[model samples]
Target: MSQRVVLGLSGGVDSAVAAYMLKKQGYDVICVFMRNWDSQLNNDILGNPTNNDPVCSQEMDYNDAKAVADALGLELKRVDFIKEYWDHVFTYFLDEYGKGRTPNPDILCNKEIKFKAFLQYAEELDADYIATGHYARVEHRDGDDVMLRGVDGNKDQTYFLCQLNQHQLKKSLFPIGELTKPEVRQIAHDLHLPVADKKDSTGICFIGERDFREFLKNYIPAKPGKIVDYATKKVIGEHQGIMYYTIGQRRGLEIGGKGGPWFVIGKEYDQNILYVASGDSNQWLLSDEALITGVNWISSTKPEGDFDCTAKFRYRQKDNDVSIRFINEDTIYVTFKKPIKAVTPGQAAVFYDGEVCLGGGTIDKVYHNNKELEYL
Candidate 1:
């Protein structure tokens, strides 16, 4: 009998192609459509698709996943993770935002919703392994297991997946890690999958299909604020609210005095003050080292001593060389070889060594010995 691999089909080209590849490799495949959110959230008129930005085509997505599974000649199962998402992801998102901290809910969603839920579901179905379309590699490191980056540098998703513990990586399978996004699309095209041309999913998972602010409006009550340059204390613009904005944002600021270009430097939640500054100010916006807290080592043994590796502080950030020094059981200090721009708080800083994912943690604070941004 062939090994059976239960796959998570997310109604996208990547997951569809993953199903095909696993079947072709002689694994007895069963594709599962993870219903992380209920459809009623979309069909409800008050919570209509137009009202919320994240609630896109749930019916279409569920159908697409089902159709792909049928076409691949596999049994399809749907698991509802609504309760888990609410308890773990949504609560964290709202709490972090409430505290003026920008949390990466996607990371929490992966940790609490998809992998954790799907793995349990797969075990109940007597499967050998659970698989998904993430662009990261999982390998046996020295007898223990670890995850690494994908072969395609441009589309690597290990950053979002850094929170996975050793046990999770031990059983996870990322079918598209060895291939690039274009290559995965090609595979889907070759397989004649329905989602061959389907656009990749973006933004916070399961909060689909709503204008971000409009969707957020339902959750977080808005508060308007003034945009001022911290250096000059001159009110150059007015913002919708500090909650809607993010660090390093350039557009929609509505600032004048275009001496250069102003970007979001920081926000003062208590005072309702949004700080704007020239985009080119390295001293105010950039930093070399940051203290990352809540570290998770996918390996059983945490790395000790000064270790050199590449890390990404936020999603879409290019890899940069860094020296990571373990500070304690729960923290580490990462010194970038060169100053990295906008090392934002409440983001994950994932370290890597080629395809092997070292580990990662939450960014808590940035520091410069004598001359640092006084406000931060």
Candidate 2:
């Protein structure tokens, strides 16, 4: 009997190709389209409809997904995860921003929804494994599943999947992990897939390409605040809200008619003050170390106590050599080998040893010298 693999088939080139590849491998492929967001259910806090788009993007995506599944001769299933996404991913997203911290919802979405909820759905289908189009690879060795970076360095997505655990990795498959973006597109083209020439989706997951501030205002009430200079402590300008702005953000300050351009250095949550410093690479933005919490170790070979590895504080960032000291079972204090700029709280600090992913944790606090940057 052929192994049955349930695949998450987003209406995009990558996932379309993933579905095709799984079928070619002789697996009984079942394609599922996950509907995780609905603008109708997401009204403003004041009970007014926020989105007014004439055409719904999610519906269009489902149409494309159905076309792909039909062309590939696979069974397509549509599932609603809107409530689960709200409770698990979106709530945490709003809470982190409320605390004046920049959170990566993509990380949490993978941990809670794709691998957890969707994996459960796949299991109920009596499948041997679940697959996606993520550009990452899993290696089974010595009775443990190990995640490795995708072969395409530029398109590697292991950073987002860092929060996945042993069981998730064991049952998961990344069909396009070894292929580059162009290669995946080419395969789709050859297969005459409808999404072969479709543009890749960008911006926040499910939120689509809407104005970020406007979309956020639908959920969190915006409180306008004052923007201050960090070095002089002088009021420079006014801001929409501290929650909308993030550390190291340079655009949309609207503080025009200035001596020069300025970048957000920190945020005072209690005071509702947004702090800025002149110049893009301000010294005030640099940090020497950070305190990480909610750590998850995915590697089969776990390191005890203090250890050395390379880590990326944000996605697409080059790895940096770091020293890690275990503070607790789920926490660590990491000292960067070099002074890294803008190590913001609530973002992930994903660690890697060569190509193998060693798991990671969310950044809780940042420090320069020995003093904590409590303002952020």
Candidate 3:
């Protein structure tokens, strides 16, 4: 019998093509659609009913996934991880925001949900490996498995999966990792899959495209705060909530007649103040060093002393040259070769040695020169 592999069919063009590739490669492919959220319980931030609508987009995704499975003559399995997501991912998301920090829930979803929850469930099916549509690659290097960036640099998703360890990398397969986005879409189109023309999903994994502020208001109560101009330390406008804004944000400030556009520079959570600076290139927004915590080294061993590598503080950002020094087991201090802007706390600072993902951790503190930000 051929080796069995469980493929996560997310009702997207990328996953549809991944399923086809896995099946063609002689693996006994079983499609599994993971339902990580229940829209019935959704409400606006203000506790108002989201209102009755037609079938939720998730249900439509399931329908499309089923169609793709049927078209490919594969058996589709459905699994629910709503509870797991709430406990492992959503709680952390709320906690980080509550602390006035910006967290990337997509990165947590990959670490705690797809790799952890989904991998365990795949094991229950007696499968040899589990596959997904993520644009990243897993390779056996030396005596261990290594996670590498996908061939399509623009769509490489290795950053999100930076928390994954060697064990998860060993059991995971990214069939579309070697193909470009357009190539995957072309394959899906050629195969006549229903999701071939479907648009790519963005934003948080399960949340889809919605009013972010309105969605967040449901979990974290909005507290009106003062928006202060950093240059003059004068209150320019009132903000809905300090947590709703992030460093380097330019829109929705509503502070006009200031002679220039305003950019968020810092936040004083205790004082409930949001600091803004005029002009796109504000020196206050730049940080030369940062303290990172909760580091997970993919190789299960920490690199010694100071080392040079390229790092990315946010997704889709060009990697910047930096030097990292270990502060302890779970913490490190990084100094960038060039000062970068908006190095927000609670976001991951992923390090890379060429294409190999070296793992990362949440940014805890940002420093400008030798001094820490006043608000932090």
Candidate 4:
């Protein structure tokens, strides 16, 4: 009997091509679509009027996924993960925003929903392995599974998958890991997949194309606050809420200031104040060190002492050289070789050792010149 592989067939070009590749590899491919959010249900929570569209985005995606599964002559299953997503991912998202910190829910979604909950469902299906459209690679080396950067440098998604554990990596496969975005699209086109020309989804998966602030306001009531100039300490403008903004945000501040286009320098959560700096390269924007918590090293054995490696504070950011020292089993004090700008608390700090992905953690604190940034 052929090895049965369960593939997550998201209604996108990447996963469509992934299913094609898996089938070509002679595995018994089964497709699974994860329904994690509902726009109407969320609207009800906010007490806001819901859209009248008969078919929701998730349903449209399911239709696309089903088309691809049928085209490839495979069995497709739809699973509901709404409750799990709410408890594990969305709750954390709201809590972080409430605390005046930026949170990457995509990372948590992968950790809690796709990998954890989805993997469990796959196991119950008696599948030999599970796979996704993510642009990342897993290599088995000498009795260990190592997650590596995908071949496509520009589209590498290992940062989001950095929270995945050893067992998850061991059981997961990325069929499109070796292909570029263009190449994946080409394969889909050649296969005549239904989502061949579908546009890539952006922003948060649950929020879709909705305005982020408006979506957030439904959950967290807007508290109008003062936007102050960091240097002058003068009230520049007013903001809707601190939870709607983030460190390093430049646009959307309606400040008619003398000096700047203004970048968010710091946020005083207690005072409900959002501070802005004039220049992009302002001193307040840079930081030489950060304290990260809930760190997860992929390898079972943690490094003994301080070690040199590189890290990315955000998904698209370039790696920065850093020295890591364990504060405890789940914490690390990272000293950036050069000052990094806008290393926001509550955002993830994913570590990398060249192409190999080291597990990462949430950034709990940021410091400059040995003083913790208390404002943000």
Candidate 5:
């Protein structure tokens, strides 16, 4: 009997091509569609509070995923992880934002939902391995698994999967990790998959192409706050809410006619103040050191003492050379060789050793010139 491999068909070209490749590899491929969100939770993305109509995008995605599964002659299963997502990921997301911190829910979703919830469900289905179309690779060496970046740097998604541990890595497969986005699209087109021409989904995975601020208001009540200039400490404008903004955000400030485009440097949650600074290269936004917590080493072990590595403060950011010293079991003090921009608390700082992902943690504190910022 062929080994069973459950593939997450996300109704995207990448996953569709992944399914095709898995079937070609002669594994018993089973397609699973993870329903992680409920569209009935809020109004439409346009901020219309009266619009109670349910969105059909999730249904449409399921249909597309079913079509691909049928084309590949694989059994399709639908799993609802909405509750799990709410309990494990969404609550933490809201809590972080409530604390005036920008949290990456996608990273939490991967660790809590896809790998934990979905992986457990897949195991119940008697599958040997579960796979996703994520642009990352897993390798086994020295009786341990190591996660690596995808061959296509532009589409590499290792940052999101940085929280994954050794057990999860061992059972996961990324079939399209070695292929570029164009190549994945081409393969999907050649296979005549339904999602071949479908536009890639952006923004939050569950929220789909929605206005972020409007969607956020559905859960968190918008609190009007004063936007203060970081340099002069002058109140320049009002903000909808501190939760709606993030570090280094420049647009939607409504502070036009100002000397320069203003970037968010800090948030004072106690005072509900949004701190902004003029110029793109504001010194307040740059930091040379950070304290990270909730660290998960993928190998299930921490490196001894301080060591050199590269890290990414955000997705799509170029790696920065850094030295990491373990402060404790779940914390690390990272000193960047050069100051990095907008090292926001609550966002992850994923470390890497070349192509290999070395795990990471949430940035809990940021320091400039060895002085910790008071606002964070």
Candidate 6:
């Protein structure tokens, strides 16, 4: 039997082009646009206040995907995964922020929601494999599947795909892994797809539009608090809420003090306190050692003993040269060659060796016991 491929169409150029390419590959192609977010919330963000479209309608997106699906003469499937999305992604985002932890909801969304949910959905439909517009590469090593950064370095999304396991990677497909963004757009245009040049998706993972601050404020109320200098412990200004802010934030602070502009280095969730420290000093919020928990090792187990690897503490950050030690079953102690700034407590530290992504987990704490507080 021929391989059956199910591609997720976002009514965008990437996915449209992806479907076209898959069909050209001689595989059985089926386009599935998972309606993950509510349409009422998204249309409002797109400035469609009237919002005639029902929640999670994806009417416009579906139309664009359908055109590509029909052009390729393939089947199309529309699956509503809103309940799963809310339980897995949206709720996780809110709960993290509620606790003053800046969680990467996209990472969770991919690991638990889209890839896992859609993979199961496809299997139920008797599909052979699941494909998407994700700009990452997949490989098999030691009979275990692995996810890696894409060939197009600028658009590489291995950061978001780090959480996927061996099973998901084995059954996954990334059609645009080798093409640049422009090349993708060109392919879409050549195919005469309606979303040949659709604007790239940004901000939150699924929801296309909506003010993040305003939307977050709905669930997590803005509790007023003082912005204090971590060095002086002097209260300089006020902040709406500590939960709304994260490490390395400068704007919307509404605070100005001596020693140049300050950035948010930390937050006090219990007291509704906000910590402001100067970026001029390298030591303000920077630290060397980090404790990572909730690890998901892709394809295999952790490396034996301490070894050299590049660890990225935040999204879009270049991998840092580091050494690691397994602290426990799920926790690891990672120390960077140089101090990495703003080691936010809630962000994940993804470990990599060249293009191969090992695994990553949420940062539990940032410690600096090796340094001296006497210097400050």
Best by TM-score, which number?
2
All candidates' lDDT scores?
A: 0.80, 0.89, 0.87, 0.87, 0.87, 0.80
Q: What would the TM-score be for candidate 2 when compared with the true structure? A: 0.96
Clash tally for model 5: 0
Can you write out model 2's per-residue Cα lDDT over 203-303, one digit (the tens) per residue?
77766777778778777779999999888899989999998887888899998777548889889888999998886564778889999999998955567
Kindly list the per-residue Cα lDDT of model 5 for residues 282-343, writing each as its tens digit. Answer: 46777899999999888767789889999999999999999999978889999999988888
Model 4 pairs in collision = none
For model 4, residues 305-328, the per-residue Cα lDDT tens digits are: 899999999999999999999979
Task: Tell me model 3's lDDT, rounded to 2 decimals.
Answer: 0.87
- Give the best candidate by lDDT: 2
Candidate 1 per-residue C-alpha lDDT over 232-266 given as tens digits, one digit per residue, 9 for 90 to 100: 99987788877777788888887665554888878
List TM-score per model, in order.
Answer: 0.92, 0.96, 0.95, 0.95, 0.95, 0.91
- Please give the lDDT score at residue 58 for candidate 5: 83
Worst 10 residues of 6 by lDDT: 367-376
Backbone N/Cα/C clashes per model: 14, 0, 2, 0, 0, 1
Model 3 stretches with alpha carbons more than 4 Å out: 42-55
Lowest lDDT block of 10, candidate 5: 39-48
| lDDT by residue (tens digit), candidate 6, 179-252 | 99889988877777778877887878876666677666545567888888887889888888777787888778
Model 3 is weakest, by summed lDDT over 10 consecutive residues, at 45-54
